[model samples]
Target: MVSGTVLLLLTVLSVCGKAAAERKLVYVTVLFRHGDRSPVKAYPTDPYQENDWPQGFGQLSQEGMRQHFDLGQFLRNRYKGFLNESYDRHEISVRSTDYDRTLMSAEANLAGLYPPSGRQVFNPNLPWQPIPVHTVPQSEERLLSFPLGDCPRYKQLMNETEHTEEFLNVTKTYKDIIDLVRNKTGLNKTNVESVWSVYDTLFCESRHNMSAPDWVTPELMEKLRILKDFGFRVMFGVYKQQDKSRLQGGMLLGEIVKNLSTMADAESKKQLKFMMLSAHDTTVAALQASLNVFNGRQPPYASCQIFELYKDDNGSASVSMFYRNNSKADAYQLQLPGCALDCPLEDFVKITKLSISDDRDKECQLPSEGRDKEVIISLAVSGCLLIFLIALLLGVICWQKEPVSSRGYHHVINREVGEES
Candidate 1:
């Protein structure tokens, strides 16, 4: 009897496992960096200038287009039946930063994702059809850009980060290398924050097989590479990573989580299936930092961070993340720090709460500096007093300048008497 009962329980457990495996994909959000591009800017002594590039500085190259196209094809294969075979504006949304390269990359990606078919085809000669990739002005781009310039709190955090023990140690250890870059690259400033620019320009030049300066030896290149990676960590990780993420990457992560949570509702399941965000490498790093799973290396060109939401037969939803940094390799599955690879939505949200900010503006406001607040108050009081005295002096001067009017009857009588005489 006991054996029969045990066999029945085993059969029930096998059925439950199968049901879990059949969870339906409810939604997906993908954030990817632009493909290869010309250097953003070159140092004063650099060999390659802006004019050397085909489209000048910061424009995406032909290889970049290919990278994004391949990414789109990969997405199409992954979401074969989940998404429509043709482009549907209602089902998917694409947002990109307001930069030429990112905008172009998004368009190229769309071409591979939704090749025109049947009525969707506008012209036979071209397989591509125009798809909207929306963007806001660069100044207002908080959704996809990291190390946001407008967040004063984030700036304060960065400033404090520079003073931390880890930061000081890094600076002290790499002092010689930093000095070499400053002197050789003709960069006015060379610190942990700015050293990455030199690395970036050199890395891009090397990729294009352009000759680098004699100073950039292989050993030097390796050191610059390490510093560049460290620069990324300093930007989004290193000290108080969660707080930094809340102010930088957490902003984007919060929106993505909200969207996923909304789609988890059965009523909203069909409303939207896919969301594509085209942004920078820093943006990807920030989000990964917030998730506490960043690999601490620079995200490569066309790198993609993907979030997939699935609902099991039991009506519970889970979120899964993947990072595709290399086109030649499979995307790495990222597990939320305290959860499984497929984390329950509730647990995911709870674990990520510390990184999300409800009021970004409030959080960005740094506490008043030690003595600066007193100085500001003193200056403000003095200025107010100065203004008050100036107004009083002006009032007196106006009164003194006015001519006193003679009494009407006395003035008229005196004038008449003088005329008669």
Candidate 2:
């Protein structure tokens, strides 16, 4: 009886170990928008200008700092077991766009994420310690910034999208509001794209309890908000969204999928546990759009998109996503289109491959029509050159066949006779 009991106990322990090994969280990547900030810019005729802001335009506010700090603490609680109690630089990485608001947000978040403790405390008066946040200059930033201007094909796509039925319908529906905004804001133009600025300026002003002009009413504000949301959709969706994503957000998505693949490899020496990205709402929206999961609403301040890689017992890996747009509640799980809530890493990569461009520069070349025109011109030029070459060859052939051209032969003989004399 004792021997039998020992065998059963050993079998139970083996099963439990296998269970623990299944679906182990191996890596996490969190991409978050910056906290609240002043509007990037105000309309020309708006009452508030750059001077109206405390720290000038586009700067992070105190509220923004608090929001990010709280977010970091939330992260701490959520990843309590996964993350170390102390900061480990080798285990995690933080990168942000080269903007004041994003940079400051990263700093504030790190303060809450890795508050100096016990022996590591440098300043006794403060609860924070310096943590490194990496960034690239805005001109060189492609991973986190959306709608990069370097792609001519993306620009052509936008122009094509503007002429689509859906785009035209939205434009026709908002013509009245667009005109009103143009008049009120004294802007040269107020198309769907430019109208977002009007909404952003008013939204920021309202958030801070600043009184708006008489022309701005609650009804108008709601309409503007809708238009602003539509603008974002137009930028990333509504037409050829997947193709657009391949050029824009897919770049970031590609990097993320690559990281997940690396982490999934048990033999990989990469020991990274977390990667934190601080960027703008556009970045968040762009990424979601690349995945075909954007909610079509402006992501709130400090909104985060989480990607977790889990290793299963069979040496396979899977990915799960969550969105933390609401601070009061837990992040909601997101299901990838054509995938379950917990998607296999292979499926995730495969489904997303269509969105990722193999060669963005090559793909961003002029559209087929433009390339066709270039080909036509090139063919025309080649034809002309070919005709000239053929004519020259015929001329030489005729000259050689004309009994050695008596006049040319006599001239050559006269020159040789003069040299002999």
Candidate 3:
């Protein structure tokens, strides 16, 4: 009787293990902005330039490093057993942008995620060992360097976005401040995108506790504070564009879809556990915009946007998104295209496919449309002309060993057409 019972238990365990094997596990992708730093730009009247900060501007501070380590520790706690105690080549990968802050931030994160362990830490008395983190130059970077704002279409979309209801609303709300900025900056009115820049400079300066300008009155500063609070809305939520679903939003969808598709193609049927991306706020905004799951506020420093993949009981893939930021304690959940909290990857792709815009940003184009369109039309016409010429040449050959004069005439016509093209 005892032997029979033991055999039954073994059979049950085998079945459970098999079921677990079929239902692929989890994969995670984290997209994060660099940690806090001094402002990227300074106004003409600003006191501190790049020299004010210890490492100068844009480098990660010690505070930023500690913040990322804590986050990495948080991730370690979250994925303790899933990610090996030591870095496993097959199980994990980290990609970062080429900036010093981003690269250093990634290193700090790795420090927390995979600390010295077991054999790696040779000394029982001290724990320290070297671990590798990978990165690519920003220009050549693939995974972490997407949604490049250099596209002409994205620029046009941004221009349109600036005219959206939300933008207009903000402008109306801050008209007086806009006037104040105009009077202060004395910039060309035709090229006045810098209205917002003044606020950005002041706010960043304030955060770093830099000395304020004397002209900045208390009331004006308070108004700037109000505008500062509106930063998230302006950058993400309130900024609207009819083509945003395609230009900005679709860019993000393309990335998520690409990663998921790559995994789907893998023969191992390995559950994707992590997708870490070190990127910018624009990257975050574009992604959240595409997902239609934005938090109304812009993603802040070391703001990690996580997409966790999972499997249902039936062995299907599911995905979920979460946003973590320096400003927020809790990670906010985002509703993916399909499959609920644990959404299936297939559904996720399908919903995203709809947001992709074909033209992206045609309005931002500076080059003449006439030339581009004409080139296409002309090319088609030329291709047809070439085919006609070839056919004519063949006909002439078949007619009578192709006379030199006739061939010469055909050659001249081809040359003329080529020159015109």
Candidate 4:
């Protein structure tokens, strides 16, 4: 009896160990919007100047720095065993936007994430230890530096796509905004109204409690407020017309999906545990717009979105999205439209159809049944129309073929002539 019990215990322990080993270490990719800042733009009539903010416009304040530091501490706590007590170059990598605000915020976050340890530690008199964060120039950052703040190509895309049905519908729906922009900036007879920029300006203005522009009447402000709330809808609201999405937003998604495929292809080379991007709210907006996962409100300071890909014991992969904003009490768990929270890697690539958005993906958008559904629906509609026309023609011919009594035909013809006369 004693021998049998010992053997059973050993077998059980072996099974447990094997099961644990089957699961791979978790991988995380985080894309974060920069923290709070002074307004990106100043209205011509506003009293606030560049010096009004201690750091000036488009700069992160002390509060922003503190928020990111706290966020870093949160990450350290959450990923304790996953990360070493001291930073390990092999295990982790960090990338950031080239802008000063983002670069500074990343540094502050790193300070909290790693702190100081061992001989690498600095003097005890200092408040914090130094940690290095890696970054490339804005021009070279393919992952985070998008639309490059105010890119001409992006502007061109937006302008060209404005004529599409979706853009026209959004324009017609917000027809009142043209006059409001004219009144605020005092630029008369403007031809362009970027729905995105308008919403962003209003959201920022409302948040700061700035005086409403003279052109913005109470009714108009209300409409703008609603438009502000609909930013997320405009991004992924599944509008009937899809052609307009080929603009900058589409370009942004195309890049991300291509990157994902490249990463997947190189799986045999090494484990890509995480991809971190230091970016702005606009970058976050573009990505979320593609994934159909955006909240209507602006992404707040130091907002961090996490994408987790799980490799099951059997080698199957799944993904889930987690969004943490400074303003919110808890992170949001995104439920994608067609896929589950833990979506299969294959399903992920399948849903984010490429080349449909851009010509750059000629080879990647391999012909597939899923890609042809819209064309099939259009063809079905055309076939139905043709069948209806043929049936109507046949009915007319049958009526004409009826050998009506000569008297009946003559009477009908006479009636038609009388009416015409």
Candidate 5:
């Protein structure tokens, strides 16, 4: 009896171990904001201008390089067991926006994530190996960029958003600051949307230890920060957020969902282990907003959003998300709104489909009311043209039927006939 009991216990233990081992990490996709950089531009009348930056406006700083490199190291440590010890081009892919800052950030990050190993080392003295960071021209880039300008419906939605009660309240609350900034900055107009530039300028200057003007105080800066955060909300949320997402962030989300689904398939030959995206804070915010998981704050420099796909023993797949906004802390897991922390892959896809659009261009067309007005105008103009054409044709027929005696040409025709005879 004792021997039989021990055998049953061992069998149960072995099964539990096998079950645990069956849950394997299959694929990972990471989208991270580019590291710190100088202000994209300065407001009019600001002391710091484009020339003040080391590499002019919007260039990445050395500190930015360090931040990304550190983030790369963090990633290396986090995925030490899963990722190959050496950099394998086939295992990972990196893409960045065509901006110098984002490209440099990706390169810097790779320096940390994949330092030279044996054959990859071109020079013993130089530990870094070149890793290609792919990008497309800014004009052609749609994925990984937020609030794309080409979508007419998105623009219309934004215009409608301006009139929402929440938007109106925020605008009214910040009217004084808006007017003050307009006067101080020499701008002709400054509203809640445009005032964020002032805050960004000040925030960048503050980060670089530049002194603000006498009028710019701590209290005012705080208000500006709030406004800046609200500005992000305005871009991706605030009103009809899900519809706006379908036109904006959903584009990228759809691609991610596709990638996750592809990885979930057991027969998929895609051997890619990790896909890295280096983009701006707005990109991160846009994606989070589409997921209905945005925390209503700007994603800080080097903030990373991670998606991990895992396969279970029963051939079922699951997805998990994590956000690493702070350098010192571990990436905390983010649960989908309706699903658990480890959401089933199908459930995730179903929930996210609400934000994704089947045809972006079709969805971007003018709303029904606007389309109806345009159609009505078009039909009226076409009807008038048709009526005028019919009238012209009737007048020609009437002229042909006029009596020949009434026309002097009749006499001319008779004379010509006599001459011919």
Candidate 6:
């Protein structure tokens, strides 16, 4: 009996140990914006032009490369044992937008994450191995880019959003700042939506310690910064946020969710441990907006959003999210609005469904505009009346053209044969 009790105790301990080990990380998907780059475009009155940048407009800077490299190292350290020490094409996948800055950022990031190991090193002097980074043309990039065009409903939502009380109030409050940017930047028109680009160019230049015009004082920059943040809020969420997300950010979220679901499948041969996306700040913000956890600020250079999947011994899968907006700060945990940080996969899907559209194209179509609807109805009614009038006129013309006797042919035949009399 004593021996049997000892054996039972040992069995229980072993089971617990196995359970703890089984609750291991199964898959991870990380979406990070490309690092800082030269401004995409310059304002009309700005001193810096496209020619001023070393690589011209929108190319990644050396600092941008360094930022991504550091991020890659952070990822490498974070997933030390889970991912292979060296790059494994089969175990990990990477993708980026088809822009120079984003593509180069991915390359630089990969260099740090998976420095060629042992025989894989092609050159003795340079320890770098080529890793494939996939991308679609900018026109077809729906997965990694946000605020995608071609959705009429999304456009309608945006138009409606601008008219909302909150949007109007913000716009009214910032009218003075908007006017200042218009005058300083030499732009013909400047609104809440259009001012961000101006702010972006100025902000990028400021970061590089470039001198600005006397009109662009520190106080003016602060006001522009606030407007810039408001612009992001308008893009992602201000009114009908979920509906907008269904068309914008939710598309990418659906793909991520599908990938997560695929990894959960026991029969799946693809043991894809890591999936990485290199994209823009809008991409990050749109996704965070869909999750309803946006921090209401622009995601800085090399900012990352991480989704981690874990499975336990009972074959249950759960997901956890983290946001790393500042390199200097550790990633902060994010929870779904109504769910726990480590929410079950099923529950996660269910909660996220509110933001995901079942029929994007159908949802994108605008309902008939009120004035247009009335016009169409009036035109249809007029067309029916015109047809009826034409038919009546034709009948009258036939009666007028007919001979008196032939117009009542049956009566004429009866009189001629004397049958009716």
How many clashes in each structure?
0, 0, 13, 1, 0, 1
TM-score for each model: 0.85, 0.87, 0.71, 0.65, 0.86, 0.87
Error of 3 at 59 (Å): 1.4
lDDT of 3 by residue, 60-176 (tens): 878778778778888888788778878665777777778888888787887788787766777777554455567776776534543556567555556667788766777787887
Q: Please write out the lDDT profile of model 1 over residues 1-421, one tens digit for every residue.
A: 9999999999999998888678989899999999999999999999789999999999999999999999999999989999999988888999999999999999999999999999998899999999999999998887888888887778878889999999999899999999999999887889988898999999888888999888889998898889999999999989889989889899998999899889998677366899999989998899999889999999999999999999987789999999999998878899999999999999999999889999988888876764588999999999999999999999999888876663233333457557532
Model 6 C-alpha lDDT per residue in residues 1-421, reported as the tens digit of each score: 9999999999999998987688889999999999989999999989999988999999999999999999999999889999999888889999999999999999999998999989798999997889999999998888888889888878888899889998899899989888888887889999998898998998889988889888888888888888888889999999888998999999999999999989988888996899999999999999999999998998999999999999987889999999998888788899999999889999999999999999888888776765689999999999999999999999999989988767554533376677763
User: For model 5, what is the error of residue 360's alpha carbon versus the real structure, in angstroms, after optimal superposition?
Assistant: 0.2
Residue pairs with clashing backbones, model 5: none
Total backbone clashes of candidate 1, pairs 3 or more residues apart or in separate chains: 0
Q: Please report, as a residue range, the 10-residue window in candidate 6 with the lowest summed lDDT.
A: 407-416
The alpha-carbon lDDT assigned to residue 53 of candidate 6 equals 90
Cα RMSD for candidates in order: 8.3, 6.4, 12.7, 14.0, 6.2, 5.1
User: Residue 112 of model 3: what lDDT?
Assistant: 82
Over 4 Å off in model 2, which ranges? 1-21, 368-421
The lDDT, on a scale of 0 to 1, for candidate 2 is: 0.92
> How well does candidate 5 match the true structure in TM-score terms?
0.86
Q: What local lDDT score does residue 381 receive in model 2, on the 0 to 100 scale?
A: 100
Over the full model, what C-alpha lDDT does candidate 1 score relative to the true structure? 0.91
Kindly provide the TM-score of model 3 when superposed on the true structure, using C-alpha atoms: 0.71
Candidate 5, 239-300: lDDT as tens digits: 99999899999999999999999999988998899999999999999999999999999999
Q: Which residue pairs collide, candidate 2?
A: none
